[model samples]
Target: MEKFVRVKGVAAPLPLANVDTDMIIPARYMKALTRTGLGRHLFQELRFDDADRERASFVLNRPACRDARILVADRNFGCGSSREHAVWALTDFGIRCVIAPSFGDIFSGNARKNGLLLIRLSETLCDHLRREIALAQHAAIEVDLAAQRIRLASGETIAFDVDTDDRHILMEGLDDITRTLRHADAIARFEAAIESLMTIP
Candidate 1:
């Protein structure tokens, strides 16, 4: 897991609302059984036409929005089936952080577990940021997990709310497994004691 302290990169605007997991990566592509390669199918439906031709109008397909690390989206982002692949696709595509007014509960959990920062901010503020990025190519957006704030190059900051424990996880690049490993010595000692007790009369 990579520590998400302060990420400054291209801010892609995904202005649509109710962007569910299936839309992020179609369920058909979910058969891969591995995290790698999903980036190629991220937003498969929107990125291409029915005939499999590229759609130039989609936000992510735009030349300037490619390789965007931060996504400014509308309400209810990540809304459908809780596919972990959705998180994989976004992260694989270089999107380290996502800013939206609301997010699906399951998808949000999966994202945090995978080391992606999901930010919740006012819808108005999110819109402002989205538009700002579209107006400028690779417009820089800074997300500081320790500070719980997202700032644009212009110096405007939007404070977001995140649980203390989750915030700590992002700052230290700790997933659930990593968090448990933090107490490895204690766990080993307890196991050793249990083994000795079982062997005694």
Candidate 2:
């Protein structure tokens, strides 16, 4: 997992709502447990046609959005199945932050654990950002996690709320395992104390 203190980069607009995990990476590409190489399969169905050729109509296929690191999507983004692969695919595609009106519960957890910042804002704000990205070629969005705000190209700033623990996890680049390891000494002491108590009894 990578630290996500701040991100200022091209934002791709995904206007469709109810985007599920399957649509993100598709179930066929979920064979790999590792997070690497999923970028190629991200949005496989939308990015490529049945013939496996790039679809020109897709937003991600557009030249301006090719290297987009921020994704501004519609409501109910990352809905459906609880597969963690969805988060893996997005991060692997170089997307560091996802801005939407709402997200699936499981998907949200997966994203946070993997160091992907998921910002929930009002529907109106989401629409504004999406439209802004579509109209401006090579437009960029700045997300400052420490500040809990998004800076748009029009010089407007929108505030968003994130769980405090999630914010800390992303800022510090700590995954679940790493987070647990942070208390290694305390855990070891507790285990040793319990063992000693049992032996005395």
Candidate 3:
């Protein structure tokens, strides 16, 4: 997983509230385990029409938002199922940070595990950011993880809170597997000790 230290990129406004995991990445797309290809199918239903065609009206479908790295959304985002694919899709689609008033509990955990920054702020703050993004598609937003500050393209800055351990993981690019592998030598030593103890004298 890529480390998220300080991200400065274009912000996309997803005004709708309560976007679920299924909506982010449909279950049909779960056939593939790799997170790479899911970016193409992110927001499958909303981004594309019933004919599987791109919906020009969709924020992601819009040219300005197609390459957005920071997603500014409304309240209760990422609700419903606890599929990790939802976070995968977002990160795969080049969205490193998501700012919303609230997020589904399970989805929040998934986001951190998948190296995505899920920012929870007040509803008023979210609305302010959403409006700011809508005003300018090319606006650049700066997400400083180290400082725990969100600086908008409009020159506004806001503070946010993140769990200390999660913040460390993001900063060090350490995932569960990566952390376990870091102690490979210790694990090997433990196995050797167990083998010696089991062998008859």
Candidate 4:
């Protein structure tokens, strides 16, 4: 997982609500356990038609949004399923942060673990950001995790809340395994102590 201290890049507006995990990356693409190469299939159904050809009308297919790194979405984003692939697909697609009014509980956890910042703001704020992105071509947005604020192109900054521990994890680029390894010495000591106790019994 890559550290996510701050991200400044183009933002793509996805105003639709109730976006589920499957929509982020369809289940058919879940055959691979590795996170790499999923970017090609991110939003596969929406980005491509039945013939698997790129749909020029899709927001991601649009020239301005093709390389967007920040996604501004409506409420209930990532609503269905608990697959971690959703976060993997987004990260692989170069999306570092997602701003939405709400998100699924499991998907939120998955995102944090994968070093993806999921920022929740008021519905009104989300709408404003989305509209701002739509009005401009390749509008740039800044997400500063340390400051917990989003700097918009209009010179307006919006504050957001994130758990302190999750913030630390992302800043330090520590995944669950890395986090556990930080306490390896203590874990080893405890295991040794347990072995000694077992021998006495």
lDDT of each: 0.88, 0.91, 0.89, 0.92
Q: What's model 1's TM-score?
A: 0.92
Among the numbered candidates, top lDDT falls to 4
TM-score of each: 0.92, 0.95, 0.93, 0.96
Worst 10 residues of 4 by lDDT: 130-139
In candidate 3, the residue pairs with backbone N, CA or C atoms under 3 Å apart (3 or more residues apart, or in different chains) clash, namely: none
lDDT of 4 by residue, 1-201 (tens): 799999999999888999999999999999997999999999999999999999998898998888889999999999999899999999999999999999999999999999999999989998888887767655798999999989888878888999999999999999999999999999999999999999994
**Location of the lowest summed lDDT over 10 successive residues in candidate 3:** 130-139
Clashes of 2: 0
Q: Clashes in model 2: which pairs?
A: none
lDDT of 3 by residue, 1-201 (tens): 899999998888888898998999999999895878889999999989889999899888887778889998888889998799998988888999999999999999888888999888888988888887777656788999999998887788999999999999998998889999999999999999999999968
User: What is the total number of backbone clashes in candidate 4?
Assistant: 0
* TM-score leader: 4
| Candidate RMSDs in order | 1.6, 1.3, 1.5, 1.1
Q: Decide which is better by lDDT, 1 or 2.
A: 2
Poorest stretch of ten by lDDT in candidate 2? 130-139
Per-residue accuracy of model 1 over 88-150 as CA lDDT, tens digit each: 999988899998999999999998899999989889988788777666656787888878878
Model 3 segments more than 4 A misplaced: none
Model 3 C-alpha lDDT versus the unseen true structure: 0.89
Better of 1 and 4 by TM-score: 4
